[model samples]
Target: MSAQLPEITFDEYLNEQLINSLNLQTNVIQNLAQYSRHISFQLVDIKNDVEILANRVIALHQQQQSQFLPPLQMFVQPSIPPSNSLCFFPPAMQVFPPLHKPFFSTTPDLPNKPVPFSFSTIEP
Candidate 1:
């Protein structure tokens, strides 16, 4: 004996399809909300990492500045000659002043200039 199925009206079929579509839409919305929340968390982590790196860079810059010496000032004597002197002295006596050895070396070793080279053939 074969079982007979009941016939559903067109309105009932359309209603079922609409309910399924609504359910699918609801699922998609939920998934999008979850993805948005995950992205926000990652952004927060990245922001924190950037802040840490910036602080380290600032510290390094300050350290480098401290290591370097301040600007040096040259000592200049007055241009006026002594009352006992017979001749008038120049306005400036020394143009470049010498540096102390304790703080810095006066002479630093520098690389020598490169010499020109040429190829020549020799007889055996």
Candidate 2:
């Protein structure tokens, strides 16, 4: 013999559905609150990073400016390098080898010579 299930009333079914929906909404609200807190923490970290970077940039700029005055003298007399003697480029007094003519001449009247690549004079 088959056993029959008890029938639930319409009002009882509606109350059950409402309770389930309220539970779901409560869980969603709790999850949303947790996410908001996490985002707030991340924002705080980003703000701190930005502040630290700004301070470092300011310090570096000040250091560069303090040392810039010595280099101003080099402009007047290019023969004298900066106080540190670390030149950024070839000194004005250094002579560069003359640029060699290209092997292929556009004009027939000009003869071209092959130039060898040399770095004998440049110090490492």
Candidate that would win on lDDT:
1
Q: RMSD to native for every prediction?
A: 21.5, 21.7
Please report the TM-score between candidate 1 and the true structure.
0.54
Global lDDT of each model?
Answer: 0.62, 0.60
Give residue 52's lDDT in candidate 2 (0 to 100).
69
lDDT of 2: 0.60
Question: Model 1, which residues run further than 4 Å from truth?
Answer: 71-124
Q: For residues 1-124, what per-residue lDDT tens digits would candidate 2 score against the true structure?
A: 9999999999999999999999999999999999999999998888777666655654554454455544223232355555776565556656444243323355232212322223343489
Candidate 2 minimal-lDDT segment of 10 residues: 109-118
| Clash count of each predicted structure | 0, 0
Q: Give me the runs in candidate 2 sitting further than 4 Å from their true place.
A: 70-124
lDDT of 1 by residue, 64-123 (tens): 445548633567766766788878667676445635222224423222332222122224
Candidate number with greatest TM-score: 1
